[model samples]
Target: MWSEIIGKFKGMPSQEKVVRLLLERGFQVDGQGHVVSGRIEIPHTQIAREVGVDRRVVDATTEMILKDDILKRVFMNIHSIASFKDVAPLLGLGVIIITPDNAQNIGILNDVTSVISMFNLSIRQAVTDDPFFTDEPKMTVITNDVIPGELVSELRKLKSVKSVTIQ
Candidate 1:
């Protein structure tokens, strides 16, 4: 699905960057070609600066997205989520980042969470990167308390997991 969406901007690198940024941050391209987070409008200049493209490029990209039925549907419905991984330490929560060998592989989350549950750790939140949106997708689990090294080792041994980082 992402491949198909990205293919639409084949010859337009700047537009591709704009689209990727929009998708990553869950910014919507409204019917009027404005970049918005929910109902709040985000200026084209700000988006362009973050993507290192001209404001005109951002405008053009949003216009193109709004023009396409599929893109318009996707952009209009996408949303952002509040992830706790970044602020876990400040909140005295344990953070575990799992890099999977294949994010598309099923059962990775269940297996990892089972291991964490076996240790009786209370999970605060669990977030997984959408495989289509990220090249190296990962799963982040926030726990109520620090995770033990033994559990980290067990998570690393999961067939689907490539690496495990605990904080």
Candidate 2:
């Protein structure tokens, strides 16, 4: 599905970057070509500065996205999530980051979560990076209690897991 969406921006690298940034950040391109996060409007200049493109490029990208029915539908419905990985300790939560040997491999999440569950840890949140969007995709699980070393070791032993970090 992502490949198909990206295909539309083929040969247009600036537009591709804009689209990728929008998707990664869950920023929406409205029918009127405004870039927004929920009700907050994001200025084209800001998006262009972040993406290293001109403000006109951001405007054109949003215009193109709004003009396409498929892109419009996707952008309008996408949203950002609040991930707990960075502030887990501050919030008195446990965070486990798993780097998969092969992110596309099946059962990685299930296997890791099974081990976590075996330790009787209640998961507060789980966020997985989309392989298509991120170069170093990882799975972050937030638990109610600090994750034990035993659980981390078990997670590392999973067939799909390459490394595990508990914090």
Query: How accurate locally, in lDDT, is each candidate?
Result: 0.93, 0.90
Query: Model 1: which ten-residue window has the lowest total lDDT?
Result: 24-33
1-167: candidate 1 lDDT, tens digit per residue: 98889999999999999999999998888789899998999999999999899999998998898889999999989998899888899988999999999998989999999999999999999999989888899999999998899999999889999999987
Clashes of each: 0, 0
**lDDT value for candidate 1?**
0.93
Poorly placed runs, candidate 2 (over 4 Å): none
In model 2, pairs of residues that clash are none
Let me know the TM-score candidate 1 reaches against the reference structure: 0.93
Q: Which residue pairs clash in candidate 1?
A: none
For residues 1-167, write the lDDT of model 2, one tens digit per residue.
88888899999999899999999999988778999999999999999999899999998888888888899899999999988788999998999999999999989888988899999999999999999998889999999998788888888788899888878
Which model scores highest in lDDT? 1
lDDT of 1 at 16: 98
Please report the candidate that would top TM-score against the real structure.
2
